[model samples]
Target: MQGFKKAFAEQLRLALPSQEVTLERPKDYQKGDLAFPCFKASQSLGMSPQSLASLLASKIKIKDATIEATGPYVNLRLLESVRSRETLASTLGNYPLPPQEKKNATILVEYSSPNIAKLFTIGHVRSTMLGHALANIYAQEGYEVVRLNHLGDWGTQFGTLLAAYELWAKDSNPELEKNFPWAAEYSSESTTPLHRLLQLYIRFHAEEEKNVSLREDARAWFKKLENQDPDARRLWKKFRDLSLIEFNRIYERLGVTFDSLEYGEAFYEDQIPGVLNALDSKGLLKEGENGSKVVDLSEEGFDIPCLIQKGDGTSIYASRDLAAALFRKSKWNYERCLYVAGSEQNFHFQQVFAILSKIDPWFKNKQTHVPFGLIKLPEGKMSTRKGNVIFLEDVLNEARDRIQKIISAKNPELSNQAATSEMLGTGAVIFINAFNDRNTSITFDWNKVLAFEGDTGPYVQYAHARICSIFRRAGGSWSQWAEPRSEDFGRLHFESIELPKSLQGLDHASAQHLIFELNGLEPALKASAISLSPTSLARQLLTISKAFSVFYNDSPILNVEQSEAIRQSRLLLCLATARVINQGLRWLGIFAPTEM
Candidate 1:
């Protein structure tokens, strides 16, 4: 597929040396699949744009492509046969994919770094799914992908937790609180560690407004924790571990995994001094208000210098990020490291990357901060302290329960109800946000997510299941058409079943459209991966689903009266659609259930 684009580009480059040759998609299919505008190139050639396009359309020789001149644009369409036998076959691995244009190298994707001490909220949905899908797409492109969950496990938050814990101990008594059912040491039978920590943290802030000294006490505790004082370290470790236990449960339920789970601020505490020393030696460190130390990124256009060290000699988040970058570089030796963070941190990252670039040139080109917009409820942005935050686990579980109830009402006898309900419900939550533009804030709407029609996750998954049902009903389905039956076809092996001789000559709008959609799988996947946006692929998958549905309605597979041969051929088409949909949804981190 890439070869076609390259060959076409080379042809145009040879004919028009001065033009920036690019193949654009026509707004309407009638204009052709790809188009090249010739207005500018025509001037150099001393001809009208339409005339130049016509000349190129006639002169450029492309096998299996029909070139047409439309106004000032030259449009081209691949012959359906080349699409069916070559592109389709390659996507199904009757042949290998065109050699990868990119060299195989490692990339580390760091996402879902929600701060510990607070439960994961509805806000994390976009980053987690976006990062997950990008990782999947990167692997599809043959990159050595490392998925890192950069847990926000360090910094002043831990200090706040320690201070709260100390206060709670004094007020409630350590012995009594320890013996309480939901204790610091979580057990297999008990829960609520996360709730306890969150309550303490929120209450500390609340009480601090009444007694200002509480804030100082919290800061002191955090400083002690940073200094690795025994009691403070022990308490900090307890908060960190218990928080992770809660986090792991959510990750497990949501089907998110990490190759590495590294603490951000705490992990870099030991190296932060050296980070400051390097900045100091290089004359990058500037004195900020009071005794604080900072990096002057004013030239990068900031009003205030980026504070690296506080007045009390404590390191801030920016300093931790700088040290973490150094740690990740030496540790993974990755070609690229993407930080999937919220869009609010855009300037913060730019400043950090700018400061790091001053200290280490290698940091500038390789590191990327992939920012996304906020996830807001219908009312507005939520806050944990205000008690308005929606728990992520609750949302996921509700999605499952609601789906299960619907299944019970609609298809009471459906097998594997528990498992199917879980997948579909979780997919609903994920799908609602999957196609949203990364920089646009999305308002959660249950009505929209659970909708049966339109581009919902259930809608796509149902299409896969519907295709599966077609094949199951067409018993002696193409799989057993051969002398010996083969196992089910996967992404790489769809060509195993030979199309019957009579079916080989199959050509109709339905067959042609289905094959076209099937052949387009690779290109859509490529575009999605390159753009680092899952919605591109998500939108493409929806197109394939709608196209397959049209083909399903217009073309008869098992019920056709013509002959068994044509029936089998249509069955092959159905199998191909199911395979593509299943694989595509998997890449999107959504399920394509075999049975709806």
Candidate 2:
């Protein structure tokens, strides 16, 4: 289809040698398959748009297409023969997508950096799915995509948790109480460890309000952890390991995988002294109150100092981020690195990137902070210390349970009950986050996400299942189409097949509309990939799904009034719709079910 458009554009050049011609799909199909507006050029040529359009329309002569002058535009209508089964061959291999502009280009996408002791909150879901989709889209464009989970494993918060654990949790594990007085009940079983850890964390924050000395105690324990004291190191390692096990369970359900995991703050702990010393040597580090180290940014448009290290000589986030950025450049030599964080950290990331650029002028513009909007529940924003956050795992489990009930009541005879429910539920959760623009704040609405009758994931999935049923029934009745070694049902790569003798005589408008949308997949793929938004492709898939549903209803596939040839042609259309829908859905990290 892309080649055909290019060839048609080249033909237009011959007709109007002095014109810069661009072709567009008309809003109304009756206008034309492709329309070119003559008004812009005609004004400079001192001629009316209608006259120029008519003149150009007369001069144009192409095979298997007709030209017409409609008001101020020139329209082109392709013959059925011009867009036959052979036209779809590009979608099979690599016909649709153009060659990669830069081969072996590496990109690191860092996202879903949930803290070690906290549950995976709803906000993590947004950043995680966004990064996952971007990685997939980048990979399709031939980039060496690396999905990095920059975990938040080291901070003052860990100190608070340790202090809390030492005070309240040491007695829970009597054996550990004797050997290591600070370690909590490190449950080998995954279920209770996270809950106990979060409880201790909350308790520490609540107690810190009444007892002022607890803050210093928390700071002291964190300083010990930072110094890698043997006892503190053991507990920190235990907390990190158990937390990962629970996190992986959630990620597995979402189908999100990481190529590299880095504790950015922790990974740079050793490099902190060297980095700070370099800053001092470069005259960037300055002394602050109470024996603290800071970098004055007044000249750089900041009123406060960017603290490199706290008064107690413990490194802050900025110091560690500088080390991590240099380390990544040395390790991957990546052309581009994206930090997919929340918008709440906008100023902090801005400070980090700005200071990194000032420290080394060569490191500017190569890194991006793609801060996404925060997801708010109906209640409001979440706070882990207050214990008011809605857990992502709980929401996913609820979605799965609801879908299983739907399947039981609606699709009782379906054999793949377990798999089907998961596919639908997971697809529901992913689709809502992906279909919304990344930079826009959106409320979590399970009603809209799970609706089967509207513009929702289940609606599209059912459309796929509907197409599969049509094909299955048609294949069984007409064994000729499914002859052994001649055809298969794994995937319908039917672009090269000759049009059946019966389908040659059909010219229904519904069939034409379906064909037009199918031809647009290649351009849609390029648009979605280049714009760095899967929502473009998502919206396109939804368009195709809705169109197919309309076509199926208007044109009967197995009605007694229709001939066998008509039935075959409609079935062929159904196959084409299913292929594009399935392919497009997968591109957006959605699963299309064969049966709902």
- Model 1 Cα lDDT, one tens digit per residue, 1-596: 45677777889999888688988756554455578999888887788999999999998878887888989999887776555554344544332233244656888888888788888888887888888888877876877788887777777767788888887854654442343332333343224767767767777777788999987887788788778799998877787888888888887777777886765457787999889888999999888898999888778888868989888777789988898888888887888888889999998988888887899887777888888888777898877765567677777777888889888998898999988988898888887777777888877666765565688788788877787777667766433221112221112323444444444424666667666666566677788777777877787788778888887777777776677667765666666676677677777777667776
At residue 117, candidate 2 shows an lDDT of 85
TM-score list, all predictions: 0.89, 0.86
Give the per-residue lDDT digits (tens) of candidate 2, residues 84-185: 454434433322233346568888888888888888876788888777777766776777887888787887888888888888887775332233212233
* Top TM-score prediction, candidate number: 1
Best by lDDT: 1
> How does each model score on lDDT?
0.74, 0.73
Error in Å for residue 263 of model 1: 4.7
TM-score of 2: 0.86
Q: Which residue pairs of candidate 2 clash?
A: none
* TM-score for candidate 1: 0.89
